[model samples]
Target: MTSAAGATALVLALNKPVYPLYVWFLAESAFHLSLLTALTMPLYLAVWHLSRSGKGRAARLGMVIVGIVDTLAIALILGGESETLAFLFACLMLAGLSFYRSEVWLSRGLVAAIFVLFVALEGRIGAPLMPVEEDDMRSLAFLNVTGAAALAAFIMLRFPRAERPD
Candidate 1:
């Protein structure tokens, strides 16, 4: 849950005012990617809390739903503009699985698959799904990507250290 909160704060704080605007604008404009991404936050929080409360199976189900939505969002939003977001979503999904499921190998296998996909996609040419943005915004978006990945990694790797109810 801390990872979720930290990732949320990092995303919103770093982008400051514009991130919300971007989200709102994309939502209002009916851009599926942005809308879905924004929607995933609350669902993720729910899953996190549920897992913390020992409703692991429920949490895992919610995580799967979120992952599916994220996958659709990425496909609908395709291109370089969606790259960072795609990776972030993958990280979040894998982290959730690792944290909530007893089957660790499944999560690890998915991680390996992600790595393979990235390696396979290397050097592929692509265009932005949305219009090219100002440099500052681009850099900030990249920060969100890296920040999300870091938080997900922390959450998964430190799973054993998380507080557990007696």
Candidate 2:
């Protein structure tokens, strides 16, 4: 997605009326979408830079764009930026991929709890994050919780069970 499209989608998803930080700014959906892209500068840059593989630049760019857009969509709709739900979930996804790649599950409880929390934050008991003027916090929480749990499970399944060495 072009940055603007992502932003416009995000603004609509999060702030449904979909204007701007300032109403007087006078911009189109395209403009708002661009803002969203600009808003996720750090994440986009990091993804674009870090992902170096046989995969070409276009692949990296596509993945980075997709990841950021999905992430922000999840964030704005569920937890608002302040909740940092996006960052946490992103970390969890990366961590799971890394740790599971190596087969480890020392952090099972943490992952489980995080999963539960993500789910709970969403639809259930749902309300938009405080000060966001919306209502979907429950859904956000629940999803985060679920994501965390899934990561934990992935780790547990991939890694060897912990046992004392005799």
Point to the candidate with the largest lDDT: 1
lDDT of each: 0.48, 0.39
Cα displacement (angstroms), candidate 1, residue 166, comes to: 20
Clashes of 1: 0
Q: Which stretch of 10 consecutive residues in model 1 shows the poorest summed lDDT? A: 27-36
* Predicted structure with the largest TM-score when compared to the true one: 1
Q: Per-residue alpha-carbon lDDT of model 1 for 1-166, expressed as tens digits?
A: 3344334333433333343455444323323334434544555566566666776555654554455454445434534444444444555455444443466665666556555555555335254456444553355356446645764664455444546899
Clashing pairs in 1: none
Regions more than 4 Å wrong, model 1: 1-36, 49-53, 58-78, 81-102, 120-125, 134-137, 153-158, 162-166
What is candidate 2's lDDT per residue for 1-166, written digit by digit as tens? 1232233223223432322332213222223332443444445444434443333333333432444354545455333422435334643443333332233452354346446655664433332233332223333334445544553454345434446799
Q: How well does each candidate superpose onto the true structure, as a TM-score?
A: 0.50, 0.30
Worst 10 residues of 2 by lDDT: 22-31
